[model samples]
Target: MSTVKRWTVDVLVNDDEGRTYAEACLHSGEADTRLVGIGRAKLNPADRDIPEIGDELAAARALCDLGQRLLVEAANDIEAVTHEPVRLRR
Candidate 1:
């Protein structure tokens, strides 16, 4: 049997204390697995004032963190079921 599933990911950014913060949330909509990742980028006083750039950088960092979390969760799930060390396949 074959199956197809859709996952949703959302990234939100906010500015506070002269820094941009981003959070990435991923929902598989199955098994109640919801992953969240956070990132921040400080606004340098000497740097150009570009809000969009800060937002982009923070969002990218959050997504990268979220991806790492997903990978770790996958490894843990595999190990839990197989009772063996996980070797992630590419």
Candidate 2:
């Protein structure tokens, strides 16, 4: 039998001073797991003041971190069941 599952990810971005911060949170109902990823982008003194660019960069980094975390979690779970070391590719 096949089962259907739903997962959601929430991303929040904030800009303060010359820096931007982003946090990505993942909600997995079936596994009852919550994962969080954080990212930050800094504006250089010579760089232009573009809020959108910072937001995009920070959010992208956060999502990348979240993806890596999820992979690690999955690898751990697989190892737990297999009783051996497991390596997951990105």
Candidate 3:
């Protein structure tokens, strides 16, 4: 029988839509500066072996980028709230 391994990762990601966004990021690297997970987003078992080559960047960059996006989004949201712009439906 095959064994399953699970890891615990703590990422300071914004309250995103849910795992959908995260999974999308995992699949496509075209994630915008939106809600993201930052810091120690994940914890891999010491015994587990991770591949060297990958479509994703290093964990450090990944987390930082996520964090940055979250910050940017927050700033923009705050601006919108302060400005209180009105929208018109076309």
57-79, model 2: which lDDT tens digit per residue?
99999999999999999999999
Better of 2 and 3 by TM-score: 2
How many pairs collide in each candidate, listed in order? 0, 0, 3
Per-residue alpha-carbon lDDT of candidate 3 for residues 1-90, written as tens digits (9 for 90 to 100) = 995544333432322211111211222124332243533222244433333211132445555665566556666677788886443322
Q: Candidate 2, 11: how far from true, in Å?
A: 0.2
Candidate 3: what lDDT? Answer: 0.39
Give candidate 3's error at residue 19 in angstroms: 25
- Sequence-dependent TM-score of model 3: 0.34
How do the predictions measure up, each by TM-score?
0.89, 0.94, 0.34
Better of 1 and 2 by TM-score: 2
Error of 3 at 45 (Å): 27
Better candidate number, 1 or 3, judged by lDDT: 1
Q: Give stretches of model 3 more than 4 Å off.
A: 1-57, 84-90
Give residue 88's lDDT in candidate 2 (0 to 100).
83
Encode model 1's per-residue lDDT on 1-88: one tens digit a residue. Answer: 9998889899999987669999999999776789998888988999987988889989999999999899999999989999999977
C-alpha RMSD (angstroms) for model 1: 1.8
